[model samples]
Target chain A: MEITAIITALCLVLGSLLGITGGIGVYRLPDFFTRLHACGITDSACAFLILSGLMFQTGTSLETVKLLFILIFLLITSPTSTHALAKAALNSGETPLMEQQQTQQKREER
Target chain B: MLEAIYGASCLAILAVMGLALLRAVLGPSAFDRLMAVNMFGTKTVLLISVFGFLTGRPDFLDIALIYALVNFLGTIAVLRFFEGRKTPACYDEPAEEQKE
Candidate 1:
């Protein structure tokens, strides 16, 4: 009984740290691509860590099973959503920051 | 033990939620707002699950599941709305319709 409690405590701490770090990534990245990368990391690694910890805390119950299911669902969908966003940005003509600089350089050359 | 975990995680989620809200409010473009809203929805799911865990109830997970469904739908709806209506196949069939 005591060991399970200890484990749950550890999981909670680790999960909280990851979540916090994810939030930091969201704030610190500069451009859209960088921000997307940060969000991907948050959704993938941090989310898995937190969800796994939650599963451990839940142990072998049906809730734990549901938690695992959510983890898998997140894993598959998160990246898919990221891809959709990037593609949409591209399709809608969102210029890359690097390209914007290049275009300016060409204009200056002219 | 459960109470402590619940309280701490809830605080962390709230902190992140605040950050997301800030982004949503000050986003420079439509995409940024959309991305922020997506993050907020994801956080809400996590928050509901944690709250359910806190109260020793399982139904909140069901709510999370439903939210996930709606989030996907909402994103799709927004995308279609923003993309505007496609020109449709019949629009290009003016030559065929001319005979009718």
Candidate 2:
């Protein structure tokens, strides 16, 4: 039990660090698409770590089952939303920084 | 020991939440704002779950689960709404406006 508690604490701390990193990336990254990558880090990995940590604390119980459900739901939905957001951004003509640079280079060559 | 850890983690998550909010406020385009909002919602879900555990009420996991569902749907719905717009009004205006 003591070991499990220690592991749970570790997971929570690690997840917190990852989440903070993602948040900072979102805040400081140069472009919208780059920020999307940062958001994906928190949406997938950080959520997984934190929820799994909570599951470890719960052990075999209804609460564990609920946490598992939340974990799975987040895993599935987060990527979908990220994808949808990216697609919508593209459809709305938001060009990424890299692509803009490439086009500028092509025009200069021309 | 576990409780103290949980409390500390909760505070860290809250700080992250504030960072995400700052991004949303300072975001240059609509998509940037939307992405920040989505990230904010994700952190909110984590915050609720951790707080629930800190208070010894695991039942609050259900609320967290429901919140995850709503956040997903809300993001997608907003994306679809933006997709329907003919002109990219939100993106082009802000970048140019900020330049001046």
> Could you say which candidate leads in DockQ?
2
Cα shift from native, residue B29, model 2 (Å): 0.8
- Looking at model 2, what is the TM-score of chain A? 0.93
Which pairs of residues collide in model 1? none
- RMSD of each candidate relative to the true structure: 8.5, 2.0
Model 2 interface RMSD, in angstroms?
Answer: 1.1
Name model 1 segments beyond 4 Å from true.
Answer: A1-3, A102-110, B85-100
Give the residue spans of candidate 2 off by over 4 A: B95-100
The two-chain DockQ for each candidate, comma-separated, is: 0.19, 0.80
CA lDDT of each prediction against the hidden true structure: 0.70, 0.86
- Candidate 1 lDDT over residue span A11-100, tens digit each: 667766776776766666666666666666675665666567677667688888788777777677667777777767667666677888
* TM-score for chain A, candidates 1 onward in order: 0.76, 0.93
Candidate 1 lDDT for residue B5: 82
Candidate 1, B49-85: lDDT as tens digits: 7888788886678777666556766666666766763
